[model samples]
Target: MVVQRLQAAALLLGPLIFALSPFFWVDGHYGITGGTLIALSMVPWVYGLIGEYERLRERVPTLAGLWLLLLVIGMFGSIAFGLQGFFEGVFDITERVSLAALDEYPPHSLFLLWLPGPSFPLALLAFGVLLGWTRMAPRWVAVLVCLAAVAFPLARVLRTDWVAYIADLLMVLAFGLLAWRAWHRPVAAATSD
Candidate 1:
């Protein structure tokens, strides 16, 4: 029972955890040093959602299962992109010697713009919509997820990176709320008859 609940929360947590830079935005750590832990964290985030979808599949069927599968893939892809982009920038600096450094590679607004920014929001929003439709997560989380999807792109349209940051903060809040709700919910006993 406890394990089931933990698994459920882990599922909701996968994508959000990935976004919080599951791979540490670690500095001075060099190459795969500090980044390895960050990159490795993606495993749980990916499978977490997969496991959750398995549980959800028994309940929500239909498009919900499909959405969950896509989200799981999308979540992993986002993490990979972030990792690859960061290190690629690192290697570029090393090869160039003087062209630039990691710090200068992925600029302040690189993620702050482009399709890269929407991937997570789209994932979250899709998950939220699916969960909300099933009443698995608090309804407000679904609203926020949809809002994030809309806001991030709109902010970029308006030329405001702060909107992206704000969207990120909201996602963290949604994750916290989902975790808290799941943690507090009464766990059904595996032994209960």
Candidate 2:
């Protein structure tokens, strides 16, 4: 019961945190606010993993576990990036930083931070696929999640925000609905009576 509530909270909170990112800070590299929120959002994502375990059990335990592990790796990456931003901000390093150095090095250039950017979506897409396979969610939902994840990179490459924005919105809605269903799902009576 406690976990369910936390899961619901996390579902609601994660997107809210992302929404706050833009207003709180501008530069992704030098700003800690966004990355920190991304890191903190992991709590609910774990709740999501827990829900998967309860739903799939041994049938797809491996997939559920994999999702959890990868998502966690992504979370840790977000934390590392956030910490890097914090250090940069504290030391006032952004100004002294060179464009050439930034182009070459960049913030979160390390595997941890970079990998998570994609890993997080991959994990979600995997989980969504599994859910679709189990008929837990509509296949369209899973498809949309996958499409959205895929669109992110394309959006970046194409230099368009619409794809990313639409994809993000879809994910937010899908997760929100899933969370709602999970949290509101009724428990069976102990006895049929």
Candidate 3:
């Protein structure tokens, strides 16, 4: 029970940190750092989710590991991009080392504009689909998460900032539903194995 509570807190904290990052970290490097932290926070929740579904684990042992792999890749990619900002801040070399082609873009917007940005959401989509296939939760929960996943990549394709916010909101909704389910799930169900 205590483990579940901690897992729930980790699940909630990932999004909370991400949502508040824009405000708390104005420096672009710090923002990316926040993203890295957000990614780190998600690990325990993922582990808990996998653990909660013991039957699923017995049937498909590799799925949860795959999800963790993707999450780590996405987070590390974020950190890699953030390194540019770190270099800029630490060495004061802020003349746009290699981003000259994006002269018209905002200073740090480029980080979220491509590559790693789309990968994270796509990974989530895959994970959500797998979770749904396992039928460990209501189908609608998976559907909502899938919808949220779509929003992120769509936002990238559209090249608009507001769309990402909508995606974030959708993710929050999906995660909120998961949290509710986790909280209400019977102890016997969790301990059945």
Question: lDDT for each of the candidates?
Answer: 0.55, 0.61, 0.58
Winner by lDDT: 2
Q: Candidate 1: where are CA atoms >4 Å away?
A: 5-41, 93-120, 149-161, 189-193
lDDT of 1 by residue, 13-63 (tens): 653643444233333222343234335545655555564465468677877
Pick the TM-score winner. 2
- At residue 166, candidate 2 shows an lDDT of 65
lDDT of 3 at 59: 52
TM-score ranking from best candidate downward: 2, 3, 1
Over the stretch 1-193, how does candidate 2's per-residue lDDT look in tens digits? 6666666667656755544443444343425565465556666656665665667665777776776788777666656655655666666677247333545765546564566656766776677778789877678876766765565345433533455456557667777777777778665354241
Better of 1 and 2 by lDDT: 2
Worst 10 residues of 3 by lDDT: 21-30
Local lDDT at 75 for model 1:
55
- What is candidate 1's CA lDDT for residue 100? 45
